[model samples]
Every structure is written in structure tokens, then in C-alpha cells.
Target: MGIEQKAGNMGVVTLKLEEVINWSRTNAMWPMLFGLACCAIEMMSAQASNFDMSRFGMELMRPSPRQSDLMIVAGRVSRKMGPVLRWLYDQMPEPKWVIAMGDCASCGGVFNNYAIVQGVDEVVPVDVYVAGCPPRPEALIHGIVTLYEKVKEEKMKDWA
Candidate 1:
């Protein structure tokens, strides 16, 4: 009843440029569509109509790293595959993020062998991790939301 009443319903609002930019980034993040193992299927399910990740502004799963801002490492990273994963991560634009999905990707799951990379964090920095052998689509969605919240609180100094 204070500012709104004085404005007479006029479309007027105030926000810091940092807030505006962060909001935009959170709403339009394009995830990379690079799948490595079984968890890849679960990742795809999040994009389907049932889970419907598009509503969160992640409808497009970019196959090209150049077009992506988020990298969802949905499966385990083998020792042999570590280099490839890092290469792909390096290809994504700045202000990028990563989600380690599934137990295998997070900590090697049952594969405690040298061939397994132990955790994808060894290959690329993970921003959020969704736990489970192959996490349900809902879990993946939650991780994305968590990332969004983190992005929203980012400072201008951090972007540089």
C-alpha cells in the first residue's frame, strides 16, 4: 500500500543490474547433452514431458559444448574418459556450471577399480551433485534448481 499505492499500478520496479543478470542466467541455462553411461537415461527423462525441465528454462539440451552453460555429468567417468570429459568442459563458455548426477559419477558407485575415475570431480569441477545409483528424474530437477539458487546469489565480482 506504500510504493504501489503511490505508483497507481504503474509498471515500475527497481532491481540491481547484478540481480537482473543473474535472474536471466538462471532462467535460460542450456545444459550440455553429453551422456556417458546408464545415468544418461535418467538425465533424458528429466527433459521429457513427465518431469518437464523446459518449464525451468532448460528445454534445450545442447549437443555442442559451445552452446551450453551447464554440463550434467550423468554417468561415471572412466579413467580413459577423463581427458575427453575435461576437454568438453573446457569447450563450454564462461560462467558455466556442472552437475554430477548418480552415485557412479559422484563417487564411482560399486566400481572401485583403477579403470573408474572414482568421481567426475576429478575431471571437471562439480557445482551440484544428485545422488543415487541412477537418480530419478525428480532428483536431477532438484539439482538443477539448486544450481539456479546458487546462480541467483552470485556477485558481480565472481562473474569476472
Candidate 2:
């Protein structure tokens, strides 16, 4: 007998399977159009026909945060931009995700001098931290896929 049969329920197993499928489908994200520095150019390159981020279902770069589910903090986070970043993050709907796309965004890079926010995480919750002085397009794509996997594994109802 299968695990479902041993548990005395075929219907419950079917429902669970459906839930998993739906979660995976919905979590295929669309990232917002926001990039601050050198990393922004790399991000653009990733979306271009060359690298093609569309394969992962994340090519739709929404102009508005409300329409996007993922925010890729691609460069340095200055103190002045910190509030703006937080506001943008807040604007995004529930089940949203954030990616710190480079050393600058992840930990302020070489700019430990004044005026920088130190790390994008200080302003918004980061789901994935992609390390590199400026990570390559491949690394960015890998981070997006990693985020998708995390979203798929999330227990929706339990998440508050």
C-alpha cells in the first residue's frame, strides 16, 4: 500500500498534491525594474536576449513595485535611498521576495565610508544574498531559481 493508503486517505493526499502544484505555479515571480549602480547594468544584461531570464518566468520586469513579486537590490544602498527601498518593498504584495544582488547591496561593498546604508538587508528583508563584487548574469539567474524553490516549499496558510 502507498503512504496515502496507509494513512487511510486518498482524498487528503490529492488535496496536498494540488496545493503543492499551485504553490509552485504562483511562486514563479516577476521582478521589479529597479537597479541603482553597476549591478543594474548586469541585471539588464541578464534580461537581454543573450542571457534570457525569461526561461525562469521572471522576464517581466514590472515598472511598478505593486506588479512585481521580487525586488533585486542590485547595487549600493545609500542612506538616502534606504527609506525609498523600504517603501518600495512595502508596496509589493504579500508572498513577495527580495534579493541582495551584489557585495554592495548585500553589505555595502567597499563603501564602508559614510553615506551608505551598510547593507540592503537593513532596509528590507532579503530572501537571497548573491555574493560577488558584482555577480555575473548566471549568478543572478541562479539566485532567482533559488528564490523560486524557497517559495515553492513555503507553507502558505501557516505564513503570517
Q: Each candidate: RMSD to true structure?
A: 4.5, 6.7
Worst 10 residues of 1 by lDDT: 4-13
Cα lDDT listed for each candidate? 0.92, 0.87
lDDT by residue (31-127, candidate 1, tens digit) is: 9999999989988888887999999999998999999999999888888899999999999999899999999899899999989999898888999
Off by over 4 Å in 1: 1-10
RMSD of 1: 4.5
lDDT tens digits by residue: candidate 2, 9-65: 757334576467646664467899999999999999999999999888776899899
Work out the TM-score per prediction.
Answer: 0.91, 0.85
